[model samples]
Target: MSKIGQAISEIQTLENISREDRWVNRLHPLGKLVLTVFYITVTVSFPKYELAGLAGMLLYPLAVFTVADLSFGDALRRLRVVLPLVMIMGILNPFFDREILLTIGRVPISGGVISMLTLMVKAVLTVLAGYLLIATTPMDEICRAMRVIHIPKIFVIVVLLIYRYVTVFLSEARRITQAYELRAPKQRGVHYKVWGSLLGQMLLRSMDRANDIYESMQLRGFDGNFRLGKKAALRPADFLWPVLWALVILALRLFPVVELIGRIFV
Candidate 1:
């Protein structure tokens, strides 16, 4: 398939989680947010050269992925965009870090290179954790979680609107590309000359759609904001998941026994 077709297909796949997946989806969104932040914090707390420590961090997300019944391949695919950028940053480290920090034969390693690798792993794990959370939890729940966590009403409203409209923007972009392909006698790379007008037309159409959306909202009595009424009460499982994962992360990072096995295997 063409590049645009591939992109759209991926988007549709990511949007496919349904209410039946509620075991993972039913977790309070705030709980998921807290867990995501906690996981990131623990992963980033280690020294930059601690490859074993960083690799050990993968267990948490892997276990969660299994429990959630989420697709590992799909999550990795979504995360590919960030991974290449991390790899590129890691590749650049050797130039600036000329000091030979370690060696395993004739080959030398630098502090910056080690640090970069650690950073890359940290970034990848954190991003994967985020993707996993979003994959299992709906966007509306996430926004509602933000509200429950005492985020400002304005910020919550803005986030909700953006989440609601992002699909619209993407759909419009795909339509524009399809139209371009249809009218042009031959397919061509996006030319500089047509870009401005093409982009302007997309923006114009987006604004028109936004205006109609605003009108509809007003008719529904939206006065700059809407409230998500509290539905799912916090359950015993909600508290248990975060607390349990927090201890697992702490054990992996702090206990020498866990670290030793992690070093030996990972």
Candidate 2:
């Protein structure tokens, strides 16, 4: 799947993004993790048709994107892989609920339409917020932060392995897909007949590769313990950053700043 390749490349981009020397990259990973949870919680709590309120959620991610000196284009490029799925998820809303709700200027909008837009915005904001954390904060830092917070070792380990190895899984899948495409060049796509055998082969190949990888790790003394760097020192910003994000989120949630600006201009 092209989506698989996109995910693999996305992780590579995240690793590169984490190396940028920026204020966001310097913030304590624990702080970012807490704020990320807060953000998603508040974002999801919004009513299904509250699109204006959801617009405000964008500010936090945009601010982080700027402060981290991250590439918005690269982020959106990866996000494209997700947009179609969200669209499909919400596509039935319009057909199912056709109640007339509000007007944008002279144009009437239906409840279902509003809800669809809300879902899309919510999807984008939540995904971007999570990616912001991933891009700026290294995987090891997140595991260390989880352990610091008394999170279960098994939970942390599972999360760490999933993040680290999903890319490997996708990489294997991509290689298999490429091989299939080359072999079946006369066909538009992999033939339906080959799908099952293709997947089985991919599984066998991936397992063998994974075993080799594990053995290599054992040779290098992986020891099941993910080595984390010295705990990042807490600075004043560590305390201030989460507070600022919370305040901004609350302000945007409680009041439609966008509507207020519209009124001032009107």
Candidate 3:
């Protein structure tokens, strides 16, 4: 399959996973959303050189993966493109700060090296936290949670439409590429000279398709707001879920759990 085809398949797979019957998928979306936001906030709040403290933050993802029956390897593979981009954000940090922060045996680790590693960890943790939320919660539920929190209706609508129609956009692109390949069967890829014209054609076709969709939505009474059925009543577990995770996250942030564990063995 082509790359665009693979991307569409991956997206459909994720949507299927979100709709699966599982305990994690059944959790109130608001609680999971709040916990995800809190997790990312705490993960990024750690001191740049405090890598050991950051180690404890791994627990949240680990617990979620176990309970949700998700594969860390699969998550990593799905996020392959994004992870490298995130990790690269810290690539130049090692050259900027060279002061030695500590020594292990005969080797001295510099502040820049520690900070770079810390940044990479933060990147991975934040990305995985987001992936966990999306993997377990359907987009409609997530949008409902956003509306519950009083997010702007327009913003919510845009997000919902974008998520729903991105596949349409990709499908259009795939068709365009396939047509080009058929016409230029001997060519390996689209010629640079035709890139602009192909993109223009794709954009026009997408806009026409979008307008028809919008008209259909209006006929169906879209009314500028999503009616994602009745909101589920918040259960006791919903209340307890975020509170429990918040306490654990706060504890990890406030204490050097990794260092203390090492000291115990020492």
Candidate 4:
């Protein structure tokens, strides 16, 4: 209904994907992390011009999103926030190389266009994979996974602090936005210039809140780093599922029967 309500709902949907309950959620966060990394590695390893390979790479993350009860639509919508930047970075490719690579009817397509298309696909797929990973795995588990993988303590501490504070800042942002809408009834366009002032105020408030949180943590005897109580243990199912998926990914990548057939027929 309300903008604030919608934002909260979207965030909740993105953050929680364990709707099925038991088994999948119980898998070690490290396992999920490893699988995600594997997917990205294989996807990007293909030649940039291999459209078939790039398209095929979508299967893994899509299937995972479906089975894990993740929100594909919501993730795509969130991705729109950064798509403009991606497009800007890619725009120059077409201009730099006008050499004809292919033709449809009378119009010719250049290598630049093909490369740009590949870049866009890779960017979107990788980003969506990352979002799906976090959506299915909680932040606490991710930090614990990083530690288990022997990531440095300082990096883990920074990640944990960011995770904790980002939400605090988001809440503050939502409150300020709501307050602005209420105070300025039906205002539009140039009137929103006041956001600059509001932004500065919010920054000051955020700094104060961060200081208070630091003091609170110190009082609780928080050492320089966090230690998760116990690492998540792997179960038979956890080990089996990821391995099976990895095998499937590898088969499709190496074999690519569908692409072979397409090239032969077309």
Rank order by lDDT, top first?
3, 2, 1, 4
Higher-ranked by lDDT: 1 or 4: 1
* Candidate 2 positional error at 261, Å: 3.5
> What is candidate 4's lDDT per residue for 89-155, written digit by digit as tens?
7778889978888888999998788878887897788888888777777787888889989999989
- Order of all candidates by TM-score, from best down to worst? 3, 1, 2, 4
Screening candidate 3 with a backbone cut-off below 3 angstroms (N, C-alpha, C), the clashing residue pairs are none
Q: Cα lDDT of model 1 overall? A: 0.79
**Alpha-carbon RMSD, candidate 4:** 3.8
Compose the digit string of candidate 2's lDDT tens values, residues 159-222.
9878878877788778887887787787767788888898888788878977998899899998
Per-model TM-score, in order, reads 0.84, 0.80, 0.91, 0.77
In candidate 4, which residue pairs clash? none
RMSD of each: 3.0, 3.3, 2.0, 3.8
Say which prediction, candidate 1 or candidate 2, comes out ahead on TM-score: 1
Residues 1-266, model 3: lDDT tens digits: 99999989989988999999998898999999999999999999999999999999999999989988987886777567766786677777778888999999999999989998998888889888988998999998999999989999999989989999889889988998998899899898889999889898888887898899989998998888778897677778888988999999999998888899999998
Error of 3 at 155 (Å): 2.4
The global C-alpha lDDT for each of the candidates, from Candidate 1 onward, is: 0.79, 0.84, 0.89, 0.77
What tens-digit string does per-residue lDDT give for candidate 1 at 60-111? Answer: 8898788878777877776678878888878777688778788968888888
Model 3 / residue 39 / CA error / Å: 0.7
